[model samples]
Target: MKKLHVVAAIIKKDDKILATQRGYGEFKGLWEFPGGKIEKGESKKEALIREIKEELNADIKIDKFALDLEWQYPNFYLYMSCYECSLESDLKLLEHMNGKWLGKDELDSVQWIEADIKVVNYLKENL
Candidate 1:
């Protein structure tokens, strides 16, 4: 199986977290934390910052590392590094079709993609 190195940002504001709905690909409409694959020679933090800028048209300060986990899909194995981030600017949805601000109690309300469910579970326990 192919292995992908990806990063996800848990953009937290006050008591809510940002969740974006996928507008493209195999998992369209599924919610996820906003981030993307780590490119060769780029640090995870750098890739995360670049991805947020490209996808959300916003800047973020990566506060700290949150969680690291591996999940297996039918096609590939995902190695995800999650970080807690603070948004530095307003967000414009460029890639995702919809975005929601969910409190810890509301995290389960949306249908999250399979890979992001682990992150959600972590947030449920921690937040």
Candidate 2:
């Protein structure tokens, strides 16, 4: 099985978590944290910074590894790392169709990708 390693940002401000809606691909319109696949020779942190810049057009300071989850989908096995991140500005949705800062109680309001829904549930229980 091919391994897909992705870094996701858990950007929290005023107790709300930032979530993006995918604009294209297999998961288009589904909500997920802003991040992307690790490219060759890039460190996880480097991939994260690059991804956030590419996807959200905002600079982020990664604090720590918050969670790691294995997701088995019909097409791929995904290994995702969630990191606590602080954003420097309001995010611009460069690739996503929409974005929102959702409070814990409103997490279920948006339809999330299956893999990402696990992360949301985890956050609800722990954060």
- Indicate which candidate wins on TM-score: 1
- N/CA/C clash count, model 1: 0
List TM-scores for all candidates, in order: 0.98, 0.95
| Candidate lDDT values, in order | 0.96, 0.91
Local lDDT at 68 for model 1: 98
| Candidate 1 residue lDDT tens string, 40-126 | 999999999999999999999999999998999999999999999999999999999999999999999999999899999999998
Question: For residue 76, what is the lDDT in candidate 2?
Answer: 88
Q: Which stretches of candidate 1 lie over 4 Å from their true place?
A: none
Error of 2 at 91 (Å): 1.9
Instruction: Give lDDT tens digits, candidate 2, residues 29-115.
Output: 899998999999999899999999999889999977888999998888999989988998767889999999999999999999998
Task: Supply candidate 2's per-residue lDDT for 65.
Answer: 85
| Deviation from truth (RMSD, Å), model 1 | 0.6
